[model samples]
Target: MRNWLKIVIFLSICLPLSGTADEKSGDHSKYVRHVEQGFSAIFRGDNQTAISEFETALAIEPDHSEILHYLGMAYAQEQFWNKAADSYQRSLALMPDNIEALYSLGVVYFKLDKWADAVPVLEQVVELSPHHARGQEMLGKTLLKLRRYGDAAPALMEALTLKPQAAGTYQELGTAYLNLKEYTKAIENFQKALAFGPGRYAEPHYGLGMAYLRLGDREKSRAEMQIYQQLQKEFAEYERLARLTRAEPNNLEAWSGLASLLMSQKNYPEAVQVFQRCIELAPNNANFHHGLSRTFMALNYPKHAAEAAEKAVQLMPDQSILYNTLGSAYAMQGKRREALVTFQKAIELDSEQPYYHLNVSKLYQSFGNQKLAQEHYRAYEHLLSEQKAKQK
Candidate 1:
């Protein structure tokens, strides 16, 4: 259950499965004593010591599968996956039918990118309990990642039927539909996902927003974006921005932060309006022009983006990002020559941004300028390699 729920549900990160020995939580008395020790240690913040106590119980009752499982779970709570996986594996060895161990091991394998190992174990779980919603759901997601969309569909569908209320299952089904280009079905599932997992979930709504945008439902896309905005706001953030701007009404950074928050909330029209107001508040401010230009782009008013971009460039001739923004606006308007010139100017201004290079490469590729595109691709690759080397 943890494995099936953790992988697809948490997206590469697994939440801890620390079993509680709470007296009111379980029935096994002797097992409960050790579990309580582990729980107490964990709660008291002596996790490593708590882990040892759980390990000792497993040793005293060498055949106690439950003790082994909880010990593994304790290790997992501390993010010691290798130890956790080993404990789960030992539990499985003792009790081959241990679903918890199987599930947890699956998550560990997935986290380690041991997809091959994960697939067989999860498949076994699904086969053992064909109607288990979580098992089917996890197998479906794993299959999707393996690009077996056709095979993934039936399992995901079955999982949805059993767990109709699991928003994440719907999201996965939507992803499967998306990969298959089953747009109508994808949208349907996505909407269901929104109903289930919409609040505070970044990816589901981001996916739905993109899907609506693809279907030319701009208003729906904006609506989904509004939820993302609502979830992202914190009291601290609002207070921080307010303080940062209190003494600097004309501060470009502060104004940009406020503008960004408003934009995320899908107040695009207001964001555009506020940015225009900001530009007037500080007419010669390059950032205000930049902020206004982005707002116009979000509003899908490309012509306005172009004008704002032009103003930003005029004010900050050395800012490559501003030129890139303007170039995008020009490209959207099909002003090919202007886009090209501005893109070139942006590269001359800032030679390090791979995106700037990639943008120009894409434009050239669209125009069938294979030679120019290849040059830029090579440059981008070189930069990427250098960055990776630095990280090492």
Candidate 2:
């Protein structure tokens, strides 16, 4: 009877314990698998897939803080601010001391324009990790947004100490000083910002203009304000073009205009990217390839320029401008004979284009063919004179 009781106890305790352990192990494995897949999708910029995988992982491990944080990142990437905030909040609830979650929550609040809400969370972030430059910077900006200039100044100063070359931070700090009626300090910070970004950013110029105006330096203020106005106009146009592209991704005209604008701004790298995107949208369009070639040339990537220009010529053989661009690329690459041939082709396609004749003339000059060079040069001069007469 005792032996029977012992067997019963063993079966009841050991069998159930073994089954529970196996079930837990299986659940853990499944949760990890889903989490891994979620991260992989996020790395590939597939936020929807990442969100789905993270949601599945969350279902399996409902209280996992790290998983919640990752889900928040995917949501943030999709610009679902509220959803991202909720995920971060939930993650922080499970791990209240998590500095990353706190910082992320603060950033989301800032994005949502919840300046009041962002303050305490960012405060917590800095409190937990005093050396976190980005957290300090965001906190300072949030404080500035709230118009707490006094509090913002020191925070921003600390941020600057951590990251001395931050142009935006300098701009924000200058604004803080301007609000505090410290015109000289504001000017100094604004100048520092301009030193970093120059013509690429507008806010520092505007702030400098304001500070100069306060100091009764009307001449300097006017100059600075004029530049600010021009920069603002360019920024507005950029925003308009950006919105158009977002609204109509396949609009070749919009893409081309944006790429052209970037090139005009001397943002060669960004122009290259936009031109590449234009090519992706319309692979057979020679203009996009030509634009890319020009951008690559501006960047001094002669090999890349040659390749892109070659593609453009192949796509639109009859286009004289494509041949001219290819010739320019070949010239840059020291392929003098190829460049001469290509430039001659451009002139043959459109004899009225003075630049084509000019290019061929230069190539002939390089080859010591003085007679041909002078002949082409005269043709270039004649065509240019005709163009000028038409303009008149």
Candidate 3:
């Protein structure tokens, strides 16, 4: 319970029959030994070794329910949810009443985000093993994901009854209460979760903030939101130094980090402001100009984007990406001649860039240059086909 990551529910296997000296075929003891080794591997977090040992056990007894279940647990440990689901399905086919297999299969489906599939399998788990806290918790979480707040509330409450100290259960129940518009209950559960859970857990803080807002406690809501933001700022690697940028305005790295974080969060206008500040400090930084151009384009200010992109191109004439951005900005502004020349320049710099060819093809098509359009279009198709083949 202390290590939440130790969540996999593994199937326990019995050793081979003691008096099987004369009834053995191809060494049944060896299969049992491999299963034991697989179990050891799983305990040590060596999932690949566990997979191999389980696979060896399966080779001896292909229809083995226990071996299939062990292999599924190994796959689940490796985050191979699809393979884990398949292995559990095979195990279930051999032994339908196997609670371990049912629970594992449901957990795998949950991992795959197949909430509908998970619901029935997990429902059966709680039905058979009514006091199974983990099963109840998973079912509650899945139902919450599916927006079945009414059903989730009961299951989460039952899970809390089964495991009174579980912070995650409290957090999930808080979410359910929030969705049901029980603001007081939501705030209570969220506070309980924050009290018991790790300090870095941001979700409960966010939930508490929402609950406070709903209750018209604006000051408390703002306080909780500030805590949530501070937690997020600490957890995100790139955004860690964002606040430092305000104190040390000349720190280009801090400003760049903040700008990148804003850009990734799609706060394009804020990112543009940050990049402008960065450019003011370091005018020759080509990447900053390029970032500003991209942010401007994201904001659909093509003319401003073109000016910023042209500066980036001027600073780094050989960079294909700057030309591509400049060309796209030109195309957006209906400067067909300039866009065609720039797109062609980008292709000449890096013919392997598929987008450059695609843009040129579009530009040609716009001007009725049928021959050039066909040539570039064929090139773009060929590059895309090659990329797909490489992926395979």
- How much does each candidate deviate from the true structure in C-alpha RMSD? 23.4, 3.7, 23.2
TM-score of structure candidate 1: 0.48
Query: Model 1: per-residue lDDT, tens digit, 40-119?
Result: 98788787878888876665456778778877877887888899889889889989887767877877777666767887
Which order, best to worst by lDDT? 2, 3, 1
lDDT of 1 at 35: 68
Q: Which residue pairs in candidate 3 collide?
A: none
The model with the greater lDDT, 1 or 3, is 3
Query: Which wins on lDDT, candidate 2 or candidate 3?
Result: 2
Task: Give the worst 10-residue stretch by lDDT in candidate 1.
Answer: 15-24
Q: What residue runs in model 3 are displaced by over 4 Å at the alpha carbon?
A: 1-24, 238-392
lDDT of 2 at 30: 94
Model 3 lDDT tens row, 1-392? 63543433221122234335435754688888998999999999999999999999888777999889989989998998898999999999999988889999988888888999999999999999999999999999999999999999999999999999899999999999999999999999999998888646799999999999999999999999999998787557544666588678799888988888778767797889999999999999899999999999999999999999999999999999999999999999999999999999999999987778999999999999999999999999999999889999
**lDDT scores of the candidates, listed in order:** 0.80, 0.94, 0.91
Error of 2 at 239 (Å): 2.7
lDDT of 3: 0.91
If both were scored by TM-score, which would come out higher, candidate 2 or candidate 3?
2
